[model samples]
Target: MFTRMNGIVCLTMALLLGCVASIATADEALDKAFEALKTYKWGQDRATLGAIDAAVVASHKDDAAKKDLEAKLVAVLKSDAPQAAKDFVCRKLSLIGSAASVPALAALLPDEKLSHMGRYALERMPCDEAVAAMRDGMGKVKGLVKVGVINSLGVRRDAASTAALVGLLEDSDPQIAGAAAAALGAIGSPDAAKALGAYQAKAPKELKLAAADAYLACAERLLADGKANEAKMIYMTLAKPDQPKHVRLAATRGLLAAAGQK
Candidate 1:
């Protein structure tokens, strides 16, 4: 009886060892897949990243495993990899669209190589950290970086950042100024209307479109502020034939909506 029992116990131990080895092999395969994706070769890298993402989605049932994989992904983003690779990682984090990556992504704003990518990623992020980063970067940054900052702040719809965006309406760069005006319109802040009027004065015909849209935004805010008549006037001015095509479109729609109320 003792000899038979010893043989059975040894067989069970061997089976357990085999199972453990198989699991280790699978983990190694996953790690290798992640590394291959780090090359960013497009076809192979995209495929590998897809696999990793699917694995992450499937492993949610095991909290510890999910956390471990996410930690690894964060490390990959922080690694000294090629910009292409880092870009892929940044886009992937944006795809995950969880607020968890906000802090990490915000930290990359000052990295010259990653600034544009970081801003693009932040546009998709739309969290407090992302808003704060865009607001803080606006004054000190310039050129395309500043343009990106404006775009990000606008997309986030941070009401508190409206003042900063309004300030950019006077920016020397036409693109920056125009985008800021558009953002103000998108935000629809009542306080932004006066600033937008200043923007309209200096804006060219093309830039006027942005200003016209912003006027509509200001009009909406006025309506909410119990100034429906003032909103109606601005809306009518926007719809004039002399206005740019885009401005006329915004104005016509606003006037139609207000007229319907009568």
Candidate 2:
């Protein structure tokens, strides 16, 4: 059984992949769509939402228009536009473009254009190549780059990266550790839960919070598998106020949720 996040992540990739097809051309429609993107601030404005949607839909039917739009999007990604525009392009790639744009998007990751947004774009890529790139690049990078890989793997639900994620839970950098713990929580696997639990005693506040979330999630699955005692202890720890506020809050809610479960 997939978790809610896992289902949404898979559905996102599937939907993006499914949307890849040739677009037809019509000057009025293409112009309207581009205007929508510009006016809506790249889909952030509710008023221009319809126009943005129209543009994306129109692009699917116009090959020349689609290529032109993708080029524009990439340029938007590269341009000195407001941070909001760059962010919107990076975050909405899957929503408006095909997998073919993935290579171009991936190329942006190293451009020093916007490090954080580049990571966001890479995470949104609709292909396994993105995961491979993150994994292969992990050892060569540190700090935010490593954090990006942790996030991308979680969003992808790439279980194969679980061991690497677990290893990062103890990384010298607390942010990296925290990201690893959060990724594990998002992955929500029993193995990840156990890995998090094993480090709970020494993890920092943020890492502890993340570990607690993962532990509670994992405990739920374990409880579902008849590991009652094990699950109870994790819930018990989480419910204690002595824990970090986030951890305590998560644990208390987890306990309540677990109690009502059959």
Candidate 3:
């Protein structure tokens, strides 16, 4: 009995030591991977990033580990790393990021080259900070970069952005104005619908059609939210004869939907 117990003890000790060694190896791999990621570029072997990827997968069930990884990624974003490296880090953060990742991601939003990927991560983060970051970025970027931020806000359907977006409807750049209209439509709030309605009359001919479509989109959203009366009113407006044929058709369908008719 004594000999058998000794053998079991030895086996247990060996397994424990093996586990410790494995953990040490994984930690070392993670460290090396981060170091390599600092200068990582496209077309190079992806094995370095692969290490971090595996760590992310393994951390799915471990919230603490995930947060630690997120911190590391945020650091990479703040580093003087190549844009390629930051881009890779953003993709990872999109998977495991939290509010902690917001500041780093937000800092990239005004950068024309980095804004898209930055938005890519912020868009997935379900936090008020992420929305605020994009909103703040709106004031700092212009042209297509600003438009991209506006589109991200729209995708989030952030109701808080409604007022700002409504103001953007009059931007000197038609493209910016048009994107704002589309975003407000996606938001689909009563405020958004109201804003679209107000913009329609003054909208340029080229923009009239877009504004009408956006109005229709807002009405659909209202109907979905059980605001049938409000939806019917918008549908009725678009059902007018002066509206485009397609717009009138869509309005008619919306009117029927509001009435609970087939």
Q: Rate the local accuracy (lDDT) of all candidates.
A: 0.72, 0.67, 0.91
Q: Write the per-residue lDDT of candidate 1 for residues 7-102, one digit (tens) a residue.
A: 999999999999999888778777876887666654444665665666666675776766666566667777776677777767766645345566
Over 4 Å off, model 1: 1-26, 37-45, 59-67, 97-100, 110-113, 204-206, 217-230, 240-242, 245-253
| Better by lDDT, candidate 2 or 1 | 1
- Model 3 earns a TM-score of 0.96
- Model 3 alpha-carbon drift over 4 Å, by segment: none
Residue 26 in candidate 2, Cα distance off native in Å: 5.6
The alpha-carbon lDDT assigned to residue 87 of candidate 3 equals 92
| Ranked by lDDT, top first | 3, 1, 2
Candidate 2 at 111: error in angstroms? 4.6
- Sort the candidates on TM-score, descending order: 3, 1, 2
The TM-score of predicted model 2 comes to: 0.59
Query: Which of the predicted structures, 2 or 3, would earn the higher lDDT when compared with the native?
Result: 3
Q: State which candidate, 2 or 3, has the greater TM-score.
A: 3
Better TM-score candidate (1, 2): 1
The residue-by-residue lDDT of candidate 2 on 1-262, one tens digit each, is: 8899999999998877666522233445556655555534533754443444455567776888666766767766655556556666666565555555665565555444455665676676667776666666565566776677677777776667789888888799988888887777666666777787787887877566667766776677666776666666678877777677777777677677667666
